[model samples]
Target: MAVRSHSTRVQSFSLSGYHGKPTRGTVTIREFNREQRMRRALEGLGKWWGVALLSVFIPVAHFVLVPSFLLYGMWQLCQRLGTAELATDAHGACPDCGTEQTFELAPRWRAPQPVTCKQCHRGLRLTVPS
Candidate 1:
């Protein structure tokens, strides 16, 4: 595996609830190059394969564990290879409750994803401003 380097940027995003004005927020976006993506995919594969190898000593459990890990590693490899950008962190105020706080975002940074407010516990939608 090659040494991996990722470029990151902070971008402004929008948060909107069912009934309220949208709120502005910032998100940390990590962009992966081809080499970085390959490195990440290989790392995932190696990690899962390592687990699968260890599971071989678990007697009868190896039958299930090994196959599951092998398949999961392939799936992760595809996912990592396809993913070019990831959302690492997000911060914004709840549109409904007007409380400001950090938000837990999904790893894949696609717009119009569903998010929950920490203070109000209400469902909100996150989007990139056009």
Candidate 2:
């Protein structure tokens, strides 16, 4: 008896079907490409639109709605094309400002580096004892 590993299984997928999760790499950390980020920004806008219509009494509504859309567009463009960088999860926080903002990682913006904090505008770096 042999144990099978997850990635080892040869799952056959059809032309019109999905075989496995389309997303790749580790999920704990969030990574984004241009298309993916644009999609997110648009989604944020959509959510704000819904909130505006449904939650009239929402106190945070006024400040949140427009900002969501703006951040989305800005982030979408922030990510440079053909670049690879490491980013925290979408809900990740900035160590400097303490704002829960995910960084837009891009190669041209400087690849081979950890994602930056959007709010604090600081580059996220791994510390090593020297």
Top of the candidates by lDDT: 1
lDDT of 2 by residue, 21-93 (tens): 1211111234455565556556655665555555445577747765565555455444433323333333344
Clashes of each: 0, 1
Model 2 spans > 4 angstroms off: 1-28, 56-130
- Candidate 1 C-alpha lDDT tens digits along 4-113: 46789999999999888999999999999888888899999999999999999999999999999999999989999988999977999999999999999877888989
- Clash count, predicted structure 1: 0
**Prediction 1 global C-alpha lDDT:** 0.91
For model 2, what is the error of residue 78's alpha carbon versus the real structure, in angstroms, after optimal superposition? 8.1
What lDDT, from 0 to 1, does candidate 2 have?
0.41
Q: What is the TM-score of each candidate against the true structure?
A: 0.89, 0.29
Q: What is the C-alpha lDDT of each candidate?
A: 0.91, 0.41
